[model samples]
Target: MNQPHHRPDPYTERPWLNPAISPFIQIQGVTKRFGDFTAVNAVDLAIYQGELFALLGGSGCGKTTLLRMLAGFETPTEGRIIIDGLDMTEVPPYERPVNMMFQSYALFPHMNVFNNIAYGLRRDGIKSDELKRRVNDIIDMVELNPLTHRRPHQLSGGQRQRVALARALVKQPKVLLLDEPLAALDKRLREQTQFELMNIQDQLGITFVVVTHDQEEAMTLATRIAVMGAGQFEQVGTPADIYENPQTRFIAGFIGSANLLSGTVQDCQPEKGTDDAPDTSRVQIVTDEGNQLLSVSTDRVVAAGDAVTLAIRPEKISVTLQDSAVSDTADKVPDNAPNTVSNNGSGTVPGYVSGNVPENVLWGTVQEMAYLGRLSTFRIKTDAGPTLEVTAPNQRRVLDNRHLIDWDDRVRLTFSSDSAVLLTR
Candidate 1:
């Protein structure tokens, strides 16, 4: 469970800008409202070209509304949107070089695959021969040559999705918008189609933006993700960046399962005998961690006595039984000072409590166990009052801990402070 404490300090500046790279699409203070309800708040965003980006959030979070604004289906009440150096504030959907694929796959049941792929071209008054050539090329690109003559009902769900994609790409727009493109397929087909979509996006080199509520799907498909909440972007970065370096509690909790512990900073010890003193902090988060608190880096104007939240991911934690092998023992606090020697382990750090195991372990009872073939998930209810979720992989059937961690059995969970993240809220 998380412990809470209080301190006095004004909130610092929020860091959401990434000015390291060139931006292809820019949105400044964009907002949308209807009646007395606001669907989208004032938000700033930057999206690069030739990138597969995802807007991820739960329903009513305005992800779909943001996408519709980009596609010109809805106009923003304030701010400006620039795509490929053109101001798109008032540009109509048809006039803009953008195409959107609806979530429903809105294909005509009466039209064959060829005609479906050529519908946009024919509506735009393209020449017959060129339209046929482009339609056939896209049909072959999607690997739908065998089903080119089949209507929407004649093909499988996956094939029909491909046909819809082919039609969307037939116009060769500068940017493509996909709205929950894989939400209709079954789990197995959706997994397979994700890879196919990546391959096609790379091969075509068109900028693609997908809106989804599925966290795993966004992590798998997007080069970068914008996690939305309350109609605003909480954080935007690559899948790894969003997972590892979340800027807020919302991002930390929304992106993955994180353990957020709130406390007051007791001390700030900088790295001694190092040139990088200003970049790191040896801050004590709470009255825990045995005076060897984790180091965190930030320029958020924090002092020794301040309120903050330390966020840590579940997988980063290491669990062991109480009687298991003892690892570290170097940091034995004597009186008021910390131990002089560092517990830098080659593989396993030396024990901290000298000859005894440290008191960092949390005792818990396994409340539930779910075996998912190669790995097992154990939900343990700790004495701290929060249920901790732990995933243990099953390598050797004989060595499986699943048998040891039965319901109501006592277990100990421990993890290093370095694996834990420190946050402000």
Candidate 2:
């Protein structure tokens, strides 16, 4: 079993270790409810200073409600919200040192670009000269100096979004909240604005909490992501951490596309042949073909005869049409001969699998193919059950590989045990 790598980096400290001194914003056991429905369940989270954090989920998942609670637009039913070492449980929206950029770009139609951005300062009774300096500095920062006199209707959608961002950051709040900041912009504009937002955050060194439903946007923008589901956070980690090492079945399926395989736990072995030895406290997974077993590497205790689910992302798996036999290079795979026959092996199923393959291969037929700009997607129908989604890179100016394997042509999908994760519930 491969040990779970939980050791912290020597240069930096882990956030959860020192919750008292680590967080610029802390939501401890926070819950929100309206009428009989609970929009947000009990959730505990912390956002460090000068970091970009993303709360990502689909609609009605309480991600919006959680953001509202942090912005002081909605009060929590239980628990406390502490920002910058100040308990804001009883703080009102206007009094708290927090600002939120709404999704709809709530700029007043009667107000021009300068007045709209200067509205917050004017309301706070700041003198005209200071307000002018602050507003001009922000206008220069957002590159809206040329469009100062333009109204909301006169500007493009992306320009209006920059105005809203300028207004949100003008207050110099310790925590800045953005609700779907780039949702209104076009695809190209959104992509450009992501880098702009990142640059602004780095320059100002302010903590940013953004809410986004776009997975790609979250992966790009967030230093750490809190993936929400059913009004609670499923997992909180870096985008790479969450995508590569999902802890649960729902997390594996939600974060990205994953292939889930169900099997029964067999005898545990350190290597391959030690299954019947005396030290057999660990659990092993067995496939249907024969005595094919995969060791469970997690620290979670499991017994023999337990049912387990293996989750593997499509990108971790590599597919080859012309396969004789390749060595299992990953240490995660058991070191032993094939006790079980591969469903896609050459002689076991004619024309379905390649010859003398490993036991981890599966047989499938290519039903459909789609050539995206950078990658080609394949919808393969596997005999094991469901339709598998596979991707191949387009390296050069070459035609599709349809001549080698066309519609209804069977193929093999081979992956190692390390690529697959054992999901225990």
Task: Output the number of the lDDT-best candidate.
Answer: 2
lDDT computed for candidate 1: 0.75
lDDT of 1 at 150: 89
Compose the digit string of candidate 2's lDDT tens values, residues 1-425. 23336655522434544545567898999989898989899999988887799999999989999989888889999989999989997798998899889999899899999999999988799877999999999999999999999999999999999999999889888888999999988999999999999999989988899999988899999988999988999899989878877877888888878877667775443433354333323345664433344433444456667787767677665555422223332212221323353545333421112234332555567889776767767777765555667776756544655444446766666665445677775
RMSD of each: 9.3, 6.5
Q: Which pairs of residues collide in model 2?
A: none
lDDT of 1 by residue, 1-425 (tens): 02223532211111124344557788889999977778899989888777899999999999999999999999999889899989998999988888888898889999998888888898899978898899989988889998888889998888889988999899998889999999999999999999999998889988899999999999999988999998898888889888988889998899878877666675565543345334555455542333223334443446777978777676665554433423343333222232222445132222222124442445566889887767667787665445667777766573544464567776666655445667776
Off by over 4 Å in 2: 1-20, 270-284, 287-299, 323-359, 383-386, 400-406
TM-score of 1: 0.82
